[model samples]
Target: MCFRIVIFVLFSISASMAQEPQEYLDFILPLIKEAGKELLTADNYQVEHKKEVYDLVTIYDRRIEDILINKIKKKYPNHKFIGEEESEINGISNLTDTPTWIIDPIDGTSNFVRQIPFAAISVGLVINKEQTMGVVYNPFLNECFTAIKGEGAYLNGNKIKTNGQTDINKTCFTYELSLARNEKYGDMYMYRLKHLTRVIPGIRSYGSATISLCYVAAGRIDAYQCDGLYPWDAAAGVLIVREAGGYVCDSNGGEFNLMDPNYLATSTKKLSDEIMAIERIADEERIRDAKAKTEG
Candidate 1:
């Protein structure tokens, strides 16, 4: 009787776990679409700077964040929320193991401010410290990227996958340097960019992390790398990439941590390794230079 009870309990737990991501995805999809509609129709937005001069925030960022947070909190009162705008307002810095919603209401605020039509709304759901679901919507382009853990990724209701390109020399890569918050890191980023540009055939920067990751998932780009990113910036996109059969990790080829400020993602593990090799060399040189300056 005890053994039978244990089997039933295990089955129940498995069933619940399997349904969690789907449930969250169902709830978030419509919300994301609605928010994207709001962004597409928005006008006369007031923009402001965050900690850095280049770090921008707009009124729509706050409005959309508030709308999402309020709706989510109403639905799941116990679930936690980590929003970019709210984090700045409330000083929330850490992510816990509880179910949490990590959101970047306007992922490409700079582009939005410039009317560049390249921005997106990024939403990531984490449960027990693992990314379970992600949704990214580009209203201007009419593209919606969605993923549920253990399931495949989708773009506008169609399955997506990485380009599966292995050759670094022939691949198109994106290196985003705008997210670097400090001057020292900016210099290091430029140094790495110079080396990568020499080896890789086509290099581009779209200035939007969310869209960059989606593009990688959709096989539009071979790889994307950047440092000094927040969890809200990567939480959604990383899951979508992983579900789309891509590889993601820290720049050092370590396991991906959403809280970490650095990220390297590629369509294939081979391509990731090749890019990391170059990044590793640049990182070593940067470390040596920093140590030399300190000792000098």
Candidate 2:
């Protein structure tokens, strides 16, 4: 009977929170701040390697994720979660129609381990399979980027938007060069990097996908493209960028898919088109080169 009552109370709380979904920011922000405080002062990162050498994780990553998920599960017991650490341990969970939280306890563990300010704690809410709310907080830098579906995006409690740049060469481009280390995808990454460098002046890989996407939303960077990221990495930041009036699409010049998010985000549609055209040309060349090599 006690267990049944507890379950009923949790379900009720979740229903109430869902009704006034805007209250989500209120419930999550404080928890992020508290976790950030701990992150900022931790003397040792206790980092470890994942699948790749560049793929790093720290104690704070798991600890902060636990804190966020535990608090949220207790407060809204009926809700579901897809968190980075939990997913790592239990295998990635499938999204359902139920309201779900997608979380990356620390989005840039490499940066966090190095004391780089680009690291962030990312959380995004999905309802009926649509991304509805997002928060990416970089405790080391004290920047919090937030967005609710159709409500616009904000940074540090102030409204933010992209710069509306469209010229391909003129736009500031960002790419995650480190991911090119993947044995399977490295060749494609290399081709893109080579082709893009020849067209654009340079590129920036700031080591954090969440902050880089937030940067696009804030107009600090004009464009960002990355592939091979988990749902938690893109869920929050992608929504934030869209809310800030930026253009986002699957890296393949199609609609964005949160689950397989290889995306290109830009200040405007024109820029997205121009960049995608160039990428198509580069990929064509890559295919031709591979065919020639195979024939040889």
Candidate 3:
């Protein structure tokens, strides 16, 4: 009887440890901070050939990724990690169902290379392929945005929530113009921006996806939109935005998943819909433009 009771007690303790979000955050946050600090020391970054035109990977990016990956692997040897550099190095292209760490060592590589303050270290912990904990750190700004699945999001240890603002015309908009200006996607975004500027009081672009989402959580910005952002870029921020009483999804009004390459995160559902409507109009105009060019 005592043996059985001992086994039951051990199992209960193990389950509780496994289920805690704080436990995961305790393991992740410091590693991200350390990696971010080390990344700042990298001055000589070599950019090589890649599949995408503007996509770049620097030495600092790889070094930080290695640090994060090594730390996670050492602590949780069984857990899987899908890092941006590893994916590029190995040419691996799929996310798995195992407990995974989705990491963007430096989210805005272009900004990092240019010594811009908007780049960040984005780290997310996924359990059974679902994002559960995220830590986004910007060393240049000394800001940390963190979220644990149900425990709520935080900025520098203070509890953060989305400002529940409903006034669209009075709201501020943050845009990410990632796609090339001449591409069809770029044209669509341009038209949407023109419409948004006329409706909103102010528009801003910080060039960092993680920071933009963090800004939304902190109520610094009312809404943000972008096309072709990867899962690692927004995984942690998505949870932060949603937990702060904001809604985030793809442009089509569908549920946004980690795999989707587009995101429209806002303070309210109404704003999200309005933003999507503008996109639809821009898309229609792009189609019309293409047709006109062909006919001419």
Candidate 4:
């Protein structure tokens, strides 16, 4: 009957959609491990500056990105790729609805260049502009953080969840100042930091957005905030946080989008609200200061 055919077609579409993330996971997990090994062993890789003196890129970053892009293109020729190095080279600015891989071959290039061991290779898959799979591997720590949409997040194959800490005063949080990249924004972040330090038990910056988000998912840090992040810097970590029962959004509490450059991630919605409240205050003060300067 026609009705039976319609039901079968709908079920088939639903089933295929459900299976896609897992299929991508199966393809990416081993690639992540292999890339992690290369990152850990590459000692002679060249380092370079990009855009600013503080923004760094290394030969390993390019090499790993090349490896991943090639393999992915070969396997899924129709899929798109948005890699940090490639974007830097080609000036790719738009993210399409076509299935895409957003990659940060080495997230903490400064740390990696200094042999600080806090770097990670972060990869995130987006299908129809929605994040579906994420893998962040820290070679030095041998930690692999992964998430599949609708499934729970995992660290080293063990299921992980956020700390569930709601009290701002009792919680420890991370704020990545390096990503501010602009003096005014950095000043605003410092202003927030001063307020946070007065109340929170502890504050830290791991200098790696991917690791900071993974730590939040693992319950190691209660929240993290940063601005001026690229899609690759945030795509994987945001999905992992959500899968681990955490919250991620823009600075003003809007729904997170990869194209948006700001992020506030927290272990719980309550914690996120509290942090964003402080950020709002700081932002207001920054706006007031700028207005005063313009008036004067």
How does model 4 fare in lDDT? 0.89
User: Which residue runs of candidate 4 sit more than 4 Å off their true CA positions?
Assistant: 1-9, 179-184, 289-296
Per residue, candidate 1 scores C-alpha lDDT tens digits across 1-296 of 99999999999999998997899899988988998888889887678889888888988999899999999999999999999999998865577788999999998888898889899999999888888899999998999999998899999999999999999989999887654444647867866877888889998888899999999999999999887788998989999999999999887789888887478889999999998888788888888988999999
By summed lDDT, the worst window of 10 consecutive residues in model 3 runs over 178-187
Per-residue alpha-carbon lDDT of candidate 3 for residues 1-296, written as tens digits (9 for 90 to 100): 99999999999998896677688898888888878777677767567546777788787878888888888899889888778888876753466766788889988888877888889999888786777888889999899989888778899999998886677888898988765433647667766777777778988888888899989988989898777667788778888888778889886678887876578889888887777777687777877988999999
Ranking by TM-score: 4, 1, 2, 3
TM-score of 2: 0.91
| RMSD, one per candidate, in order | 2.2, 6.0, 3.1, 1.9
Residue 139's lDDT within candidate 4 is 91
Per-candidate clash tally: 0, 0, 0, 0
Instruction: Kindly list the per-residue Cα lDDT of model 2 for residues 1-296, writing each as its tens digit.
Output: 99999999999998786656588888998998898897889799777887667678888888899999999999999999999888877887788998899999988888877787888899999988999999999987789999998889999999999999977787789987674445556777778878778878758999889999999999999999988888998989999999999999998989998988889999899999988888888899999999999999
lDDT: which is higher, 2 or 3?
Answer: 2
Clashing pairs in 4: none
Please provide TM-scores, in order, for all candidate models, with all chains considered together.
0.92, 0.91, 0.88, 0.93
Model 3 has how many clashing residue pairs? Answer: 0
